[model samples]
Target: MKKLLYIDANVNRATSRTERLAQALLDRLRANEDVEVTTLVLEDEGLAPLNSARLARRTAGTAAGDFSDPVFAYAKQFAAVDEVVIAAPYWDFSFPALLKNYLELLCAQGVTFNYSDEGVPTGLVRATRAWYVTTAGGYCGDYDYGWAQVDALCRLYFGIPDVRRLSAEGLDIVTNDVDEIMADALRAIENEPL
Candidate 1:
């Protein structure tokens, strides 16, 4: 079975349009019956950005090639996954800070990546593809830095070759039909490849 990790950072669960899209994606993946999905709701994790002491400990652990610490659990799980899906609402040119915090912990060296003898960083993750889902109240245009950051990280740092994004824009525009916009996004999700 393929291990798929769904990292949910959408805060407004009560009225989250992003959650609808994410659920669509999950439903599509589950249809194959060969995928095992693991959901990680970021708000529930209570993850924090690494502190000075934690950073020092991580540095030491990486240098010593020791990855037995509980702090590496997230990285290990991420590295072992066959697929990843991130759902976060667009905010201030990027996703939520909660997703960023989770990412910080998942970027552990010798876990998600390693330095080559030539001093270049090589990815260590097992995932072959990832999907990033987001919804914007207005047109993101060239300012969707959230997807850009994730795309680059998955490809350059995590070696995921087929990183893709699904976004619903202008959902809050009074002129746009929110129902139609969401229905279109759902159609796109239905056509997404496994």
Candidate 2:
């Protein structure tokens, strides 16, 4: 079965606009395919940021070819997925710290990516496509560092050739209709090519 990995970084799980949009998109995608979806909720995962000790453990594990360590679990899953979808609300010019921490673990060398003989990076991830869904209170314009980072990771590290983004901006603008903005974003998601 085709495996789709959904990385949820929506802090406001129950009422997050980004989560709502991502769910709508995922529902449509599911309707069109026989894919198995697996979700990773970053907020509830209790992932610790990489530190000296954790880095040492990861290094040793890689050297020993023992990826049975819990820290490498996410990376293994990430590398094996056929597709990826990340839902995260824009915050303070980026996504939440929880997602960043999760990515650190998922980007483990010898797992998600490795180096070529000439030192070029080679992605080990099996995913062919990825989607990033997000909502911004104000206009993100050119300051969308979160999506940029995700796109870079998908292309440069995950070997996902197609990375698309769906976003709703100006949600907090006093003059804009929130429902309309969200509807437009959902429509974009619906119209996206799977």
Candidate 3:
């Protein structure tokens, strides 16, 4: 079965615009393929914080080999997925802290990516496409910050060329046409021109 992992990094625990968009896109994608959706709700899940020991093990080429540790298993699960979707609201010009921590777990040397001959990093995840989903309560003047980081990870580091983003800005502040803005965001997601 084709695996699609959706990582929810919002800590609201109620509802989030980015989460809704991700769900809508996932429903659409499910219509065409036999796929399994995996959700990593970072707020509820008890994920180990990537500390110096973990980082040292990862950099020292021992994290992947530490089969007894469940972190390795989680990293392996991410590496084996066919597709990935990250839903994180724009917070202080970037994604949430939980999402950052999840990414720290994914930076396994011999797993998701590796070093090339010239000491350049190369990704191993073979997803045909991936997405970065977010929403902003204000104008996207500072939006490039988060998208740029995600792009670097998904494209340059992870080798996923088809990484796309769906965003809706000024939803909370722009009350004149809030529904219209949301509808347009949904339409944009449906007609993703990536």
lDDT of 1 by residue, 1-194 (tens): 98999999999777899999999999998896689999999999989899998889899999999998878889999999999999999999999999999988988999998888887878999999899999999999999998898988889888899999998999989999999999999999998766
What is the C-alpha lDDT profile of model 3 across 140-159, one tens digit per residue?
78555777887788787777
lDDT of 3: 0.79
TM-scores vs. true structure, each candidate = 0.97, 0.97, 0.89
| Order by lDDT, highest first | 1, 2, 3
Tens digits of per-residue lDDT for model 2, 1-194: 88999999999799999999999988988988988999999988898899998899899998898888888999999999899999999998999988889888988888998878898778899999899999999999989899989989889877789899899999999999999999888888788876
What residue pairs clash in candidate 2, if any at all? Answer: none
Cα RMSD, each candidate: 1.0, 1.0, 2.1
The superposed Cα distance between candidate 2 and the true structure at residue 2, in angstroms, equals 1.2
lDDT of the candidates, in the order given: 0.92, 0.90, 0.79
Q: Give the TM-score of candidate 2.
A: 0.97
The 10 consecutive residues of candidate 2 with the worst lDDT sum are 185-194
